[model samples]
Target: MADLDAFLRDLAAESADLEALVADLPPQDWTRPTPAEGWTIAHQIGHLTWTDEVATLAAADARTGGTTFADLLTEAAPRVTTFVDEAAAEAAGAPAPELLRRWRHGRTELADTLRAVPGDAKVPWFGPPMRPGSMATARLMETWAHGQDVADALGVHRVPTDRLRSIAHIGVRTRDFAYTVRGLPVPGEEFRVELRAPSGELWTWGPADASEQVTGPVLDFCLLVTQRRHPDDLTLRATGESAAQWLNIAQAFAGPPGAGRKPGRAG
Candidate 1:
């Protein structure tokens, strides 16, 4: 079971680590394009800020049982891509220091809001309302995913750590989502997944002897699912056709299918 407090603590730690990386970036680096094509570091932070605010609203709706929240999400659904493009453009225009400040404050408030929700409550989201624990884990996953883009853009190497267990956990949990997003029936057979964490502890999900399985370093698995690293670049090995097919289109985040990192693309 997921613990709200533990997830929140991981969120804070990840946020701080990314902030450290962003804080010292040279001015030129701020405007440098990250791996996310056309998006500079400014746009990355800006996007995170915009998303943090949007997520806060979702949590607030969940808290108060606001009647119109779903309607608003529905209306916003069709234009989600447009909204992101617009937000990125607008964010790019802001000064880097201001952008960082907004993101810092927004994420803190989001953590506080989630802490108040009952552990069992399903919070409103773009896909479905999620329990507070799942919601916190989702936030942590997003932070790590976006942070990868920033790190890649600046040519910084992030040291892998056990913190990735949060992301790996989300990735493993979202195995079914990867198929559903593409209108495919989720395979009924659960694949045994074994991951070697940064701390060198073995992490296993599902049964020990499932016919299908995925085995690899936890960092690589997280990168694969977050769409940050192409399958070819990682050491992940998948047994069985279903597991192989999943690695090709695995998306840890919600919404539609993502345009994952291209094969042989430099990051």
Candidate 2:
């Protein structure tokens, strides 16, 4: 329970930080292009808003034995490869104030709905089902990742916070998913991940005796896993061939493999 509270609080803080970045932007700035190809600042927020609303529906459906989310996906599948992009583009058409309002409202609703989920009950998602706490952590990761795109568009350098620990955790946990999604063999050996956190603490994962290792700054690891920064632009060091290749294709988000940033596109 305490952990869930902490995750929820961190999720809220992450959202608030991103909101602060764009809340006061001039209307014209909302249309500014972000690093995401063909997506503007408005599209970024819109994507977050749409995902949050869908998450809220999934949580509500789980809590009530409804199949709204499953049905929607089934109906859209085999023909709607671009449903996510379509949803974001549709939401981006709203005026800035309206878009902001919808985003704020949708996130609040999602947080509240997640809190109301019964203990240990899983919520359906685009990927695997997750407990409320895990759901909140994924939300935080996405918020931070998309916030990076927005920050790049605005040329703002966000101060890295310990909240990044959640993203790093996801990055490490999703190692096998990163491989399996690409039709590649999942490595049998565990990879040791040692990242120096912003507060100068060492965040370690996997067994200390693991043969394969990845060592780097936590921010760089997070950016690499999120596909926000190209591998060449990060300072992460991989000690094994598989581990080295993983860096090139790592993605924390669920979907098909992401078209990660090009080399030298650090933002």
Candidate 3:
């Protein structure tokens, strides 16, 4: 059974972990451009902060259905690329300290809201509502993903943690959705995925003997699915054509297909 309390605890840990590195940045570093296109470190934090507020609102409301997060962006701006540009533009002018203040307070409130919501209650989101457990997991995944951009800007190495198990699990579960978002047909057959978790334990999903398979370090798989790193840059192996193809364009988050990092060009 999914432990909502455990999930919330981990989610808080992720938030705190990222905030530590960000809290001490020198003033100029706030405007440093990260690997994520057109996003300074401040913009990345701003985006996360903005999304956090929306998530908190969704959690408190049971009538959660409307434009998905991606669609919400599209509706506000013509291209997904520009969706966050406007917000980032305005935020860039704020003092870096203020930005951090907003994010810190917002995330704490979001976590509190998650803890108060009943486990089985649906929370409205960009798309269909997610149960509290799923909502918490999704928040953790996004935090880690965006945190990667922050880490890169600072040129700091982040050690893999067992919390990645949740992220990798979501990646595996969303394999078909990865293809679907791109309007590609999901492979008819199942593909097994085996991961070596950070703690040296094997975390297996799908079938062990399936013809199509993906096997690699949990860290690599998580980065691939989050579209933070191109599959070619990782040590992951794909056994069949379907699996190989899936690796090329895998995306775990909801949205239009992300223009993932390019081979030999990841920032």
Candidate 4:
């Protein structure tokens, strides 16, 4: 079982870190365009805020035996062609201060509600249902990924921290899902992944003696998996054809294939 408390704590830390980045920005700076096409720094934070609200609703519903989360999705499905972008765009229209306040409150509510959720409860999401621990990790992964966009837009270089382990973990865990969603056959054999963390500790996944392997610095791997950096811009090495192919399509987020950053875009 996951250490739920630990995950929640890390999620809080991640949110605080991102919040610090934008909290002091002039209101006009929120309109700065990020790497994501047509998305401003406000859009990045807006997306995170909107997602936190949705997750809070899901966790609360699971705890109280309510179906508002599912019902809302069912109702929105037909009317919204791309709900994620729509939500972000709508939230982005808010004044920067108001948007920041909403994000802060929404994330806090989500963390509190997830704590009250039963240990085995599955929370409804855009993809499969997730346990509280998985939900926290997912939130952290996104907070970091989108935070990267904000950081890049501001030309800020954030030092890698151990919190990235959550993103890296999800990147490895979702390997098969990456393949399946891309309409490609999942690799038959396990592929080894070995990443060296910022603290100089090694974090590894998959079986020993695996024929295919990926090895690199943890930061580069996380950037690759999150599609924040083009493959050519990363130092990750793939020892087999399967591993190489996996690198091309790797995505830590749960969604359709992402339009990864173009080469030379990494800062």
lDDT to native, each model: 0.86, 0.92, 0.84, 0.92
For model 3 the TM-score comes to: 0.91
User: Candidate 4 residues 167-238, lDDT tens each?
Assistant: 999999899999999999999999999999999999999997999999999999999999999999999999
Clashing pairs for model 2 are: none
What would the TM-scores of all predictions be? 0.94, 0.98, 0.91, 0.97
Could you give candidate 1's per-residue lDDT for residues 1-267 as a string of tens digits?
Answer: 347888888888988999999998877888988888788888888888888877777777777777555776677778877877678779778888888888989998888877777656678877667887788888888888889998888787999878899889889889999999999999999989999989889999999989999999999999999999899999999999999999998988987898888788645
| Candidate 2 CA-lDDT value | 0.92
lDDT of model 1, residue 142: 87
**103 Cα displacement, candidate 4 (Å):** 0.8
lDDT of 2 by residue, 1-267 (tens): 688889989989999999999999999999999999989999999999999999999989878879999997997796567888889999999998999999999988998898888886899998999998899999999999999999999999999999999999999999999999999999998999999999999999999988889999999999999999999998999998988989988889999999999898744
Best by TM-score: 2
> Where does candidate 4 stray beyond 4 Å?
none
lDDT-better candidate, 1 vs 4? 4
Per-residue lDDT of model 3, residues 20-129, tens digit only = 98888898999999888888888888888887887887776643443454345457766555655667666666788998889889988887877777656788775456
Query: What ranges in model 2 sit over 4 Å off?
Result: none
> What value does the lDDT take at residue 167 in candidate 4?
92
Model 1 weakest 10-residue run by lDDT: 64-73
- State in Å the error of residue 67, model 2: 0.7
What is candidate 4's TM-score against the reference?
0.97
